[model samples]
Target: MEYMVNLEQFYGPMDLLLYLIEKNEMNIYDISIALITDQYMDYIRATEHIDLDQLGEFLVMASYLLNLKSKMLLPDPVEPSEADQESPDPREELVNKLVDYKRFKLAAELLGERLSDDYPRIFYRHGSTVLPEPESELSATPRSLHRVYVRLLQDMLAQDKYQIPQGDINVGEKMSEIEHKLKLAGRPVHFLELCHRDLGRREILALFLALLELIRLGKVTALQEKRFGEIRMVIKC
Candidate 1:
């Protein structure tokens, strides 16, 4: 009676051979080539509507198994006493190939499971239809008007363009000084108050950068009460 086997159940010839070996409770190291070859051929014959490409692979394994069986049946040649090592078994190469294939197949299955588990779920958001509010116009304050006038006067006076030699300003030192002043006052300080008349252009720039760094570090907060008004610096609560 011809046994019906599903071709889909086995990946290739080696897979079918492995299944047959395990089913018969045979040791992998000492597989019975005759029994395995017979079963392998049986499975190939039983499989229905088999693809010609896939059938060729099974036929190749069948030929190798037959060749190995023929070699095992051949007589062994006499060895000299000095070379007392036993002759290598003909099945060793095939066994190693099967072992490696089985290991790789198991690993592939594990990876497939992991890929399924880690598959990402996609979510889409709907677009909004409401119109955005119009931006309000900024009106200049009296303090802002005064600051503009002072800046213009300074620009007019700076026409002479004289270069003054000054040492590099340490932003870190300026930051420490500002933090100390804020702690001493225990209240908000005016931005202009930090800019003294004696301070050179680089010194003023350093102070501004230090203030910005403090704000970025969340150690201080800068607030303007009105548009173009004086910016006040206070310690962050």
Candidate 2:
């Protein structure tokens, strides 16, 4: 009977090593390096046409296995101390690497299965031959929104140059102030209205950060009605 081996299944030397270990029903921690090396060499010789780049990696692994096998066969040198007699196994490092590789391979297989299951539910919108006009809300890009803020900051800075001689402005205090102002107004307030003439650059920045924090917390929301329009802050109901 002729035996056919599928060489394409093995990804790398570690993968091939894992397969050989499992096939022989051998413990991964106490692998028989001599037997594995001989089987690996058989596989390499059996293959007619192999990629040079891939073959190099397998050859390096084979050389390592041969060297390790030789080390295992050699008798230990005479040592005076008991601590020197309790030396670590030569296969410990290789066993650790193989264990890690096996864990990652298992995780990858799980992810691939999940992706395959969800593939059917994934929908893709087909493109139309005729292009349609974009919606008004979609027309306002982040760049335009940034420009509006920049313009507002420039106007505020041009009006006042006096720096406040105070300690670090508290973002929590600004957030409380914003909450109070929004409650009093009972409507969406303009972003610029949040800053006062007496406030310094740092104070403004702190207030802006506070607003962002509030929005992130889902307590407040910022909205732009039109393209390059005023951004309004509203307390969420």
Candidate 3:
């Protein structure tokens, strides 16, 4: 089974940072490092499951924010020079990067809009086709050509009638299935059994929520004997 995970659903750390900054109505040039870092950590902690590859960048950015905050807490070193010597802000580099990235993002959006508006109008002309001579009694008509095109389209669509698209996995339904499985086994069941490898991301998420709901309801006990071990589910008496 092929898995179709939409990575676009997740936003990068920079996007989150910008959101926080704008949400707080704070100036990008002089952001409150401590406040932003705390808010960032809250968002990170709120996420229950994350792909490590995507999470790594967020963690790195979080560390950078913390470091900036630490610097802000400390007093600046005294400068002996009186000749217009100035210390740069810790967030200067980060702010510059955010500004540049925002510019690029806006430019890409504009380009996409322009392409969408203009691309369909730019069509290639096909070479002339040899037509079959019609009998004197029969004449070719545009209506006939349109009817044939519509029939062809309808036939193409009908060919896939047997293949049904998968519907959204429901958490409540999955929870009931898990409960039935545990009752049938009369013993502990491995987590992987409940969450099949072939299941798509949406199904996996649904299964996870189902398990959590069961746990919350005190209907099942989830256990792992060792660190990084497979979770075992046992029906609660």
Candidate 4:
């Protein structure tokens, strides 16, 4: 039997930096690339069968590190310019980025912890084993399974009252724009047709997630014209 390797699990340099910084528990206020670079190289060596096309960016960053390391090694014959003296340290900039990204991640984690404490697993009313109701009252109309899914979503949003972060702005706006365009056209839009418009992986991912959110909110419905035909989305009635 032969073993197969999956290189897809390794995220790039930033992922590596996040791991190191977290492992060390050192303040992002102080970062040493000299230390980071050595560990980065060790990680690279350990990774086998990395696709060249995918690995290109990491390789470029590694080459950059080597160049910077070489520059740091060269003995200075003359003092660096006054500008260089005033300028920020490259290591410091990297540290600052790690710090900022970490803050958002920390923010989400904190919110998650708050959620656990704030909401009861189940609320008790004047009954035996009652589930909590939505913050908003739902309609008593009949619904399909899909419609029920959306109603459940509307209920969750009402109960939880999600406050969309500024970072979440782009995706929401794009999704709304998509909804508007579909509405104007007055027809169901093919999912692929909607997905193709210049959304990079992140934005595209955001749109998909937003659609799911909308589906949960009873704001959209999906339809399939044929067995293998494209799926279409229309505003839920």
Candidate 5:
């Protein structure tokens, strides 16, 4: 069997960084900036006829890594100021960003796998229970309902009992639910966790559009601490 590769499967610069770190089993915080930078540049160079527009963000990240490499080579300044003493390590922020991105990326991949596995399993399983319709005022209503239900059941069994498709989602109502979640959170929450993986595609799309609308209206703010990072949504105070 021949295997095909799709470069677009990779999300962003951080994805490449995580690959490098894991490929060599290097600690995230203790990355050898020079080594990783060279490997990253080499990968970019190896891609044939790469679109610079898509590659721009990665190139920018490469420059950042190179700058950090240069900083690592320089001697610590003598007689550092009090503010400098209180400042974080130069690589601390970058490490934190990478760690966060890796976490969400892994989570997304797991969700994808679960979805794939779930789809196949759904076809084989048979539902044993039927929901009982409520009692009605007219005796004829029960008979009519039973006939309709039997007809539907026969059609489903004849058609191999596929899952019923979901109904149209109300975007406006979903937006309100998201707003309520934000209000309850009272802080930024990871966007992925808001909609949930089990939600249908239509529902997810509605939630996403709702988020964008909220952002446009300035009722909420969407932020990424770093490029190619997980988006976080905050309720505007």
Candidate 6:
């Protein structure tokens, strides 16, 4: 069985740090080291399901922040050391950069919100192509697992700097790929079971996207046979 996962769900540490600084309206050059560190920790704690490899630069920054906080806590030397005069605050440069980035982020988000008034979603047809709708139209389209996956893809793409051509991983192709490999191994597993295999989160997400495409095209049926654990997927008749 080929296990897959997607790692695109999370943002890097710099992006996260800028968000904290902007929300607090703090000066970039003169950050309240204590406050920013606390906020960063909150975000780290909030991201509960992080795959260690996908953690991004945030983990590095987190270590830096903690180190800075620790140094600040130590008692001053009994006598001033010569190094004290030559040394500078290690955090000064990072604070300035984060502050500048925060300004740009705020402007972009404001511009985006002002121009868009709709939400986005995907809809799968029983025997045809899945239609997509912006957030403005979700109330009219029924929600299904297929639709949920599409929206997740849409949201991820939207975070990109430029509008790249939309490319879809076909569900039918993925179904064929899975089945052939399964036949080689002689076993069948639940849809979620496939999601749990040992692969990167990003790869797993890509597989789900491909699976939805196949479902939309009437190539497969993803069904749950038991309350939990087992799932059965088969080529559609």
Off by over 4 Å in 6: 1-10, 76-78, 81-87, 96-237
Model 1 lDDT-worst window of ten: 121-130
Task: Candidate 1: list runs displaced more than 4 Å.
Answer: 78-83, 117-237
Error of 6 at 131 (Å): 23
Clashes of 3: 0
**Which is the leading candidate under TM-score?**
2
Q: Write the per-residue lDDT of candidate 5 for residues 1-237, one digit (tens) a residue.
A: 133333345678898888888998999989888889888877776666656787888788888988888887887664666555655567887899998998898899887886674555443345533457877665668889999999999998888757676787987887788899989988888888876778877788898899889898898889998998888998887
Ranking by TM-score: 2, 1, 3, 5, 4, 6
What's each prediction's TM-score? Answer: 0.47, 0.48, 0.46, 0.38, 0.45, 0.36
Q: How good is model 6 by TM-score? A: 0.36
Clashes within 3 Å, all models in order:
0, 0, 0, 0, 0, 20
Better of 1 and 6 by TM-score: 1
lDDT of each: 0.86, 0.86, 0.84, 0.70, 0.80, 0.67
- How large is the C-alpha RMSD of every model relative to the true structure? 23.2, 15.8, 20.5, 20.1, 18.9, 22.1
Q: TM-score for model 2?
A: 0.48
Candidate 3 TM-score versus the reference: 0.46
Clashes of 4: 0
Regarding lDDT, does 2 or 5 come out ahead? 2
lDDT of 4 at 68: 60
lDDT of 3 by residue, 22-47 (tens): 89999988899899999888777776
Q: Is 3 or 4 the stronger prediction by TM-score?
A: 3
lDDT of 6: 0.67
Q: What is the lDDT of residue 62 in candidate 5?
A: 83
